[model samples]
Target chain A: MSGFLDILYFIVPISIAYAAPLIFTAIGGVFSERSGVINIGLEGLMVMGAFVGIVFNLFFVDTFGDWTPWVSILVAMLVSAIFSLMHAVASISFRADQVVSGVAINLLGIAIALFSVKMIYGKGQTDFIQEKIPRFNIPFLQDIPVIGPMFFKSVYGSSILAVAIAILAWFIIFKTPFGLRLRSVGEHPMAADTMGIKVNRIRYIAVIISGGLAGMGGAVYAQTMTNDFGHATINGQGFMALAAMIFGKWHPIGAMGAALFFGFAQALAISSSGIPFMQNVPSVFLYILPYALTIIALAGFIGKANGPKALGDPYIKGSR
Target chain B: MSNRLINVLVPVISIILGLLVGAVVMLVSGYDPIAGYIALWNGIFGDSYAIGETIRQISPYILAGLAVAFAFRTGLFNIGVEGQLIVGWFAAAYVGMAFELPKIIHLPLALLAAAAAGAIWGLIPGLLKATLKVHEVIVTIMMNYIALHLVNALIKVVAKGGFKTDKIQDTASLRSDFLSELTDFSTLHYGIFVALFMVFIMWFILERMKLGYELKSVGFNENAAQYAGMSVKKNIVMAMVISGAFAGLGGAMEALGTFGNMSTRAGFTGIGFDGIAVALLGANTPLGVVFGASLFGSLKYGANNMPNAANIPIEIVSIVIALIIFFVACGYIIRVGLQRIGKNKEAK
Candidate 1:
């Protein structure tokens, strides 16, 4: 019992910290995918967000002081949302292949961000920011028994915010009238169109919201984990989030759960050295666990993942 | 204009627009676009050495492009091309290092090993897509990460915990001393011939074979193909395997021709991702992929000179490449714009 508790105390906080970014990003994916647009550009949007977040934090640390990370996240969100408009214009307005457009967006995001970094810093990477997101235990919550030590200690505020947002996303996606209209557009745009729900407009909103949330996720990752942005900073995290979204079957709460599972896998990989039996295990196995599990989950071990009926098909106003 | 003319015109116009946007970006960044283009040109065609190296770089790209184009022709997206290439690279290097035989047997054996490795990687996702109805995109994406980690681990085991494996024996090398001498000591090799041959092979399979017809029918309409007594699952798996074999051969070009060894990568080589752009620019055609590969290969090879010659970052080339793909993706807009231009010409 004591050994299990010790492991929990060691692993839980790290898992939550890792999961926070994935939760935000996966929820972002849920929003876009649920609206019938496959936003594979989430990776690119995250890259943009991470780049802007680090740049903003580095430049404005003197101005914003302790609030620098938060402010940078907001700015990153706005910039990333605007950046995602290119994807929207290409795929939605111009009727480009969504997957191809997303691929272009990924390449463009990394290229433009890295180019700007070199131009500004006169180097391949930027200076690390001093003001990182703070970690603290909730005052009263820390007094609770076994749970407090495992869950409340050294917790990032972003993790709590992520969980809150997931719940809020769940409410907004499933309970609201707007949610019904969004699903209707994704499921049967023609029916939704007849009922006067401006399908394209709803899709545009969903994509923008996804961008904003994914940007926030990127910013949070840069601030809390990496504390700097480089080419490798947001590597594959966006794809992992995509996996989480899929594993969760495109549901908000389910995505959060999947994110947590992936986060646990990541945490185990990082913290395996501390555990006795795991010390001898190959690190590569741990590294491959989350991805391998995703494949398994999608391979009908869990259940069939049926996406929106109209998913990946562009709506052409009146065309069948 | 004829439909065929419009099809060619769209890609051409997109390329021009892409370059124009790149020039505008250079101007915005306070750099000389003319000097950049000049440096870019010199980098690719300044001398025999540059030309040789550029073609060497293009060899793998041609195969990668073909890999993607073949899959696209079969209604599949093999995003795991990078992962397949990695495993193929390792397999070729391993076979090359482990063997001691005549050149003919050794080289073919190494190349076959690479193709098999890549095929297995692709087959897993294909099987899942066919049997379990899992989305290939997601499975391929996962497979990529798995391949990276698994290959890296295997490399360590082979190299005794080092980052790279031992260099392959001379018998298996694709490098040609005669070609290198002709190209002013550039790393040009026999891989270019192999790449071109594979291009022809892909064309033959897709255009002249019954299997190709079956695959195309499956891609075009799975239900219709099934109704017509085709095995949709088998075609899907076969298409992925063939696509993977092409990608794997791309890895052999790097292993046997250019590098002669396999090393653990810090990230993806970007070759497979760039293959997406190449396929798109090529309009997913065999001959078109050759043109796309040449353009992309030269630009990529040329990007090295931009930082020194124009005081610009090399990433600008990547930006240009990305923009080109973006324009290609938005071909509908270009078609509309061209139609408008044609109408204006008529009015005048």
Candidate 2:
């Protein structure tokens, strides 16, 4: 029984912490992809967010006190949303190939961030932040017999916020009129345009929203996990979130599930040394498991994970 | 203006604009743009040593650019070039270390091993795309991480838990003593010949072969290709295989010429990612890729001098490259701006 409790204590917080960032980012991917703009630049946008978040926290830790991380996250989201305008202007207004533009975004994002870091800090990376987002147990839920200890104990506020946002995202995407317009534009922009809906406007908003959420996700990860910003802080997490977005078939709740699964895989890989039975297994196997599993999941096990019909196609004014 | 002139003009304009923006960024950050540019120029062509090293650095970029350009020409995006390159690096290193043969046999055998490894890596996503209708982009992205971790593990195993493998035997090396002597002992090697040959091969296949027609048609439209009695799946797989081989040869360039050994990477080397920009700047053409690779290689190699000479970060080059890609993607804007300028000049 103690062994089970020990495993729970080890696995629960780690997995949730890992999953929270992905959940936010994957849901962001869903919004953009569903609105017909392929956002391969999420990684770049996340990098910008992580950079901004760390810079803000380091500069204003005393002023914001305990609220530093949260404020930094908000600042990151705003900055990233503005940064994504470059992608929207290129891909949407200029009718650029979305993927190419996205690739440029990724490159520009990292280049600008690192260049600024070097200029400001006189180094490759920033100083570690003293304050981080705090984690705590729920008031009454931690007292429950078995479930409480596994789920509610030692939980990050950001983790809970991520799950709550996922639910809210589901409602927004599936239930709201704005969601209907967004999906319609993604499915058939021509049809949406005929219905008097502004296709480019919707796509711009969607991309901005995606940028904001991904930025928030990056900040959360930086503040809670790394406690600082560097080149490696947000490495490939955006891509993993992208995989989760696809693996979840672009559904918000489904993306959350996939993120949690990937998070579990990541947590297992990181914590394998502590587990007695799994100690003999090669770390490589654990490391590659999530990626290999994503490939397997995509190759017919999921039965055609079709994206929005017009996902990569830019909507022109009149040309079919 | 002639179509060919316009084609040349667009890239030239983009490059100039990219550099201008980079200059502006430097100025905004309180750095001397003139000094930075001067430092950059000196770094690239200061002496024979810098020239030789820059050319050597360009060799792999040429192949990596070809890999991306070939895929783009065939309507595929092989984002897995990084993964293919990784596996190829391992394969070449493995053969070079484990085998004993004459120089001629050893070098080609190592190159072939690298190509085969990259081909296999590319084949997985191609097969999945053809058979299961899975998107190649996500699959290739996944393959990258798989290759990174898998190769790292394999390196540890082969090196007895060390980060790098033993250096290759002399027989397998691409080092050219005469070239090195001419360039003041720079790391220039015979890999440039291999890169040039592959460029020619890409040109011949894409522009002069029947198979190229099929591949291009398949890329243009799978349904149309299928209707024309061509096997879409076969062409897709074949395109990826050929592209992967080019990328793998890029890895061999590093293993056999530049580094002479493979080490576990903390993260991606950014060579493959940079290949995307190279391909774009080159307009996805064979000869264009060479020029693009040269420009990129020069900038990247010269960037090392920025810290000491001008107090600028090496990432400034990356920013310039990114801006170039952005301008290329938004060529419509440039074209419109140019046309407006032309009209205004006529009125004046």
In order, what DockQ does each candidate have? 0.81, 0.78
Considering summed lDDT, which 10 consecutive residues are worst modelled in model 2 chain A? A297-306
Candidate 1 clashes: the total is 0
Each candidate's fnat = 0.89, 0.89
Per-residue lDDT for A249-274 in model 2, tens only?
A: 89999999999998988898888889
DockQ for model 2?
Answer: 0.78
> Which docking band does candidate 1 fall into?
high
Instruction: Give me the runs in candidate 2 sitting further than 4 Å from their true place.
Output: B339-348
Interface RMSD of each: 1.1, 1.4
Error of 1 at A88 (Å): 1.0
lDDT of each: 0.91, 0.90
Model 1: per-residue lDDT, tens digit, A63-85?
Answer: 99999988998999999999888
TM-score of 2: 0.98
